[model samples]
Target: MITAKTMATGLAFAVLTGGTYAGASTPKVKPNIVFILVDDLGHGDVGFNGSTYYETPHIDQLANDGLVIKNAYMYPTCSPSRTALATGKQSFRTGVYTVPVLEKGNDQVSIFSRWTVGEEHIMYSQPLADAGYKSIHLGKWHLVGPYPKKEMEASWPLKKKLGQPKPSDFSWVPYHKEHCKAYYPEGRGYLKNIGGTYRGDPALEVGGYKSKTGGYFAPFSNPFMDQKNPKDKWLTDHLTTEAINFMDEHKEGPFFINLHYYTVHRPVVARSEELTEKYMNKLGDPKTGQGMETGKKKLTTAQYATMIESLDDNVGRIAEFLDQKGLRENTLIIFTSDNGQNIGSNLQLRGKKGYIYEAGIRVPAFVNWPGKVDARRTETPVMVTDYFPTFMELAGIDYRGQLDGQSFAPLFKGEDKALQARPIFWHLASEYRNGTCSIIRKNDMKLIQFLATGELELYDLKKDPKEENNLALKNPETAQLLLKELTGWRKANNVPLPPNSSLPY
Candidate 1:
C-alpha cells in the first residue's frame, strides 16, 4: 500500500508546475511572516472568542484588523500539532504521534519508536530559505523531541538514526556544543533560535544542563535562557523583547519568525503581583468561570487571566513595533495556539487539552495582512498543517512535497469559499483523557473512533457545537458512510487498527 506521505508528495508535485495556486492576483513581493503560536490557549480564552473573563485587547484588535478563522483546528496535544505545522504532514507521515515518550525495553523498542520530525522530511523553513527569507525561532520548540542528556548521546537514536539537517536547511542558529552536534537548531532551518530548545521551558534539564531554579520566571530552569535576567523579569516580556530586537534587525524585506510563547501552560505564573491582584479584584473572591475536567472554580483562574493579559500586552507591543517600523501593511501576522487549554480552562467546549473532542482540537486563529486579508469572520475549516503550504504559496514558491494540508492562501484575499469541504484528520496513538482515538471532520459532520474498544461516535457539529449528541446509532447510514471513509483513510495511511478484544465470535 502506498503511504500517505507518498500520496501527498505526488499530489504536491502535480501542482508544482501548475499556475499560481493563490488564484489570479498574487502579491508582487512576499510579505514578512510572523507566526505567533501560543501554548495551551483555548478556543474561548481570548476576548474575541467570547471569553467573558480574560482580557485580550490586542488579540481582539488583531481580529478586528484582519480575518478570523472560526473553524481552525489543531492536534489535541503539542508535539503532533507542531509537527504538522513544520512538515505539513500528519502524525502518520512524520511518526510523531505525540511528544516522544518511549517505553524502553531491554532488547528492542516499540515498532513505533519513530518520533521527532524525520530528518528527510522538509521543514517549513527549508522552502522559505530558497525564497530569500531569513527564518528565526523563538520561545518553545517541542519539535526536536526530548532533550538528550550528554550521557545519553551514545544511545540517542535522534543523533544516529535521524541526524540533524544543515544550517542552510533552515538557519536555526544559537546551535550550542552541549546540544548533540547533529541535534542543534542551526543545522536545521532556523537562522537564530534564542531560547528555542527542545520541549517547553522550565523542563529542569535543558541540553544536558540542569537548571535548579524556578520555571517560567527569571531564574528559569532553562539553559537556553539567560540566568542574568532581572529577578522580576517575566518570560513573556523577555521573549517579546527578543522578538522586537529581531524585528528591529530584520524589518527590511521578508523574514519568517516563529514566536512560540510558553505562557498559560503550567505553573500558571503571573507576570506581576499587581496584575494578579488587579484580576483578583475584578474577578471577585471566588474567581469563578469555566474550569478544567478537574472541576470548576479552580483558583488558578486569576493567575491564568493575568497570564493571558500579559500575552495580550506583548501582542500590543509587537503591533506597535510594526507600526513604528512602517511594516504593518506589508507584514503577514498569523496568531493561534499550539493545542487546547490547560487542565483548567476552555469554557463552553467539552474536554480539555488531552482529548480529540471539539474543545481539544478546535482553536482560535486569525491572519492580519493590512490591505491584503480583509477583516471578517470565516467558518472555513482550517488545520494546523495548512499553514506550511499557505506560507510557501505566499512566498511565490510552489511546494511539491507530501503534505496532508493544502494552501488556504486564497482565503487571505477575502476568498471565503475556497476549501469549503476539506476534511481535517487527527490521530493520537498516545493516551489522553479520551483514550486512543482518531477523528475526521468533513464539513460540519465529525466522526471520532476509539482505538481501544472500536467504539464510534458521530456528531453534526453544525447542530450541536457542544457535542452533547452522538448520532452514530440514530443515524446509521451517515455513520457507516463516515466510518468507511475514516477506515479507508486509515488503511491508505497504513495506520494500525485496534484489536477487538471484547469480540465473542
Candidate 2:
C-alpha cells in the first residue's frame, strides 16, 4: 500500500515533472464498461466504507477484489454532479450550478442560472458510441431539463414570471418536451435508453411525484421505461434485469452500460416486506427512533437500509449475470454514488446532502476489473468530471475537447501518484439546503469560500477529516494561496456568483 509520505513525495515529483505520473500504457483490447451510479448514497453507507448497519456484501466484494478510491467527490446535489459526469466539464462550463430550480426560493438572493445543460455540450456517451461500443442508458437521467408541462405545472408552478410573459420566454421554455427531448439519453448518444427521463425521482404515473411508493414498487411512472412486464415488482430489480438482458443481447463485443439506479434517493420505500422486517428486527423500533436515524421526515432507518440492501442485491445479481455470461473477465465495473446521503447517516462526516462538506461531496467509489485493476485503496482525489477522460483513455479514444478534469487511468494500473498533485474544485452558485460556496482541494488541504458571506474556511483533511477545525486563520499563507487559485479558476471558467454574494476578499 502507498503511504501518505510516499504520496507526498510523489506529489512533489509530479509537480516538478509537470503533473505526469509514469505508468503502464492503456489496455490493448477495449474493455466493456459498466458504470453504476447510485443516487444519494453517502460515503459511509456501504460496508466497504465502514457501514455496519447496511449489509452490502456484493458491493463490499467488489471493493475487496478491486480498487477503492478513498477521496472521490461529486457535486453537493444530483443534477450538477450528473452533469459533470455526463459532459466531462465543470458546473460553471455547463451552466448547471445546482438542481433545475433553486430549491430555496429564487429571489434576489439566489437565481437559477440554467435550467438544464445545453444541447451544444457533447456527452461522454457520444465518444463511446463512436468507438464501436453498443451503449445503453438505464434508470435515472436527470440531465434533461425539467419535467413535462403537466407535471411541472402541477408540482412546480411558476407563481411569478421573471422574464417576458410570453410562452417562448427562456424562463418558461424548460417545461416543454421540445426543450428536453434533445437532451435525453438517446439524443445524447446512447443506442438504447430505458427509464432515462427528466424526472429526478421515481414518481408514479398515476398520482405524480407525491405517489405513495414513489414508483419504486411496480407501475413506474417513468414514461421512457417500458413497463409491459408484470413480474417487474421493484424498480431496482427491473432496471437490473434490463441491464442484464441488454448485456446478454450484445455479449459479442464491447458495450457500455450506464446503469444509473434511483434507489435510496427519495420516498424511502422498502423493496419488500421481508427485507423491511429483517432491518426492523435489527434496528429495534422506528417509533422511538431506536435504530439509525434517516434525518428525513416519514423515512425510517429500516426503510432506508432496505433500499440500500436492494441496491446491493441487484449489484450482486449483475455480477453473477456477468460471470454466468463469461463477461466478468473483460468487463470494467465502476461503482459510485452521485452525491451524499440525504436520508440515511453519512457516518462521522460533517453535513448532509446539500452542504459543501465531506458528507455531501465525498461519495463511495470503486473500480473493479477482475485481472486488470488490482485490489488496493488510494487517497487520490478524483472528481466526477474525470470519468469521461478516464473512459476515453481506456478505450484509446484521442478526444480533443475542453474537459475540466484529467484522466486518472494511471491509478488503475497501480500508479498511486497519478492524481496526487491535482486540485479538484466545486462551484455552487445557487443556495439550496446550504449556502452558495466554491471549494478547492489540493493535497490534504481544502479551502471553502462562502460566496454570500465571503467566509474562508480551510482545513487539513489529513489531520481533521471531518472538517471540525478551521485552519484559515492559523495558516494564512496556505489559505491565501488556495483562495487565489480558487478565484483564478472561477474567473477562468466564467463562474457566476449569487446575486446576494459579497466577496470581500
Candidate 3:
C-alpha cells in the first residue's frame, strides 16, 4: 500500500514537471480519462507495431502522440484478463482463470475452485466514482458471472458427457440474472453501462458464433444496448456514438469512460461491403500475399480486416470528438487490447489466444495524456493488472488495498527506472486448448511449467522473441531459480492446481 503522503509527493512532482516533455505543458485541472480496450487485437495488428496487412492510421497516430509500451502483457484469454484489469488482482484470487465452466472441466477433472469474481473485490471504478467522477462502461463485461446457479446445475449441460466437455459443447447463458446483476458495471461503480453484460462476445447474445450477423451489425440482440436510431448499422459505430454522447453530456468536468469494444472477436463479419472489398484488394496485391497463405481463408481474413478498420475508424471519431470539444489537452486516453489475435495472424509470435506463450500473453499498449505522459516508446514491461494502481495514482486517490500489481505511473513522467525488477506471474490451472500451466517472467527470462507432465520450458525473451528454443535443459540454474520463485508465489497465494498434479519445486 502506498502512503497518502508518498502519493501526494509523487503527484505533485508529476504536475510540476509536466513541461519537461516536448510540446507538453501543465494543466490546471484534473484530466478526464478514456480507456479504450479492444477485443482480440494482437501485438502486431496495429500499423505502429509493424502490421502491413491491416491499416490502422488513427491508432498509429495515437501511439506516435503518446507513450508506447513495447512489452505489455495480459492473460491468455478474456475472462482472466478483464478480471485482472478490473480488480488489480491475479486470477488465483478471483478464480476466473479462463472462460467459464466449459473450459473449466467437470468436477472429476476441474481445476478451478471458483468460477466468477466475488462481489467483495474492489474494482478500479469504485475509487474513481468516490472521487466524483462520472464513469460509463461500454461493451463486453465478462467479469460478472460465468457459472450456473445451484438450481441450474441440476440440468448441467455436461452432467453425463464423456471424459471432458469442450467449450463448444455448451451454448446457453449459464448465469442467474438477479445474481449477476449485482456484479454489473453499474453496481460496480460506473454511472452508466451501455453494452456491458455477462456475455463474452457479441455472438453469444444472438446465437453461438455462427449467427449470420453475429450481433456485430445493427439490430443487435444485446439486451443492454438500447438502439434508437435507424442509421446505427454497425455495432462499433453505435458504441462510439454513445461514448461521444456521454462525453458531450459530461463536458463540464472530469469523467471516466471505459470503452471496451467487442470487435475483431469470433463470428468475424465485415462492417460494410465497401471495407471488405477494400481489404480484399489490398490482400490480392502482389506486395502482400493473398490471405490463404496466412493460415486463415481469404474471405475470413477480409472480414476480420474490416472489423479492425471499423474499430480504428471509431477510435478516430473519439479522438476527433475530443479535439472538437477542446478536451484534447485535459483528457487522458489509453489504447490496448484484452488478448492476442483470435482469427487473424499473430505475426511472428509463438502461439495465438489460448496458449500460454508470447503471442497469447503479450499485447500492444500506449498511454496518451498530451502533456502529462511523454511521447516516447519504452521497453518497460507492464501488465493488465497494473492499470488499476496506475489509474488510482493518476486520479490522486490513496488506495490502501491488497493488489498484485505495481503502479507504472512514474513511467508516464519519463522515469525510465520507475518500476523495480520483480517477477510477474500467470497461473491458468484450467485447460483452454492447452494444458494447465503457470508462468513466471523476471526481467528478460521466462519459464513455463506444465502441471500435468511437470515439464519445464524456459526462454530468454530478449533473444527469443518468438520463444522457439526451450533453454530449461541448457541453463538449469536460471530455470530452477525461476521455478522456485514461481512455486513460492503459488504457495503464498494458495493458487489452486489441477487434481493429482505435482510440482517439482
- Per-candidate clashes, comma-separated: 10, 0, 0
Once fitted onto the true fold, the runs of candidate 3 whose alpha carbons sit more than 4 angstroms away are: 1-28, 101-109, 113-115, 146-179, 204-207, 228-230, 284-296, 418-420
Q: Which residue window of length 10 is worst by lDDT in model 3?
A: 17-26
Model 3 alpha-carbon miss at residue 393, Å? 0.4
Superposition error at 235 for model 3 (Å): 0.3
Best by lDDT: 2
Ranking by TM-score: 3, 2, 1
Q: Give per-model TM-scores.
A: 0.83, 0.86, 0.87
Q: CA lDDT of 136 in candidate 1? A: 77
Q: Model 1 Cα displacement at 143 (Å)?
A: 1.5
lDDT on C-alpha atoms for all candidate structures: 0.70, 0.77, 0.77
TM-score of 2: 0.86
Residue 378 in candidate 2, Cα distance off native in Å: 0.6
Candidate 1 lDDT, 395-494, residue by residue in tens = 8876566677788877876654548876778876545455566788988999988775778899999898879999999999988888788877787667
| Residue pairs that clash (backbone atoms under 3 angstroms), model 3 | none
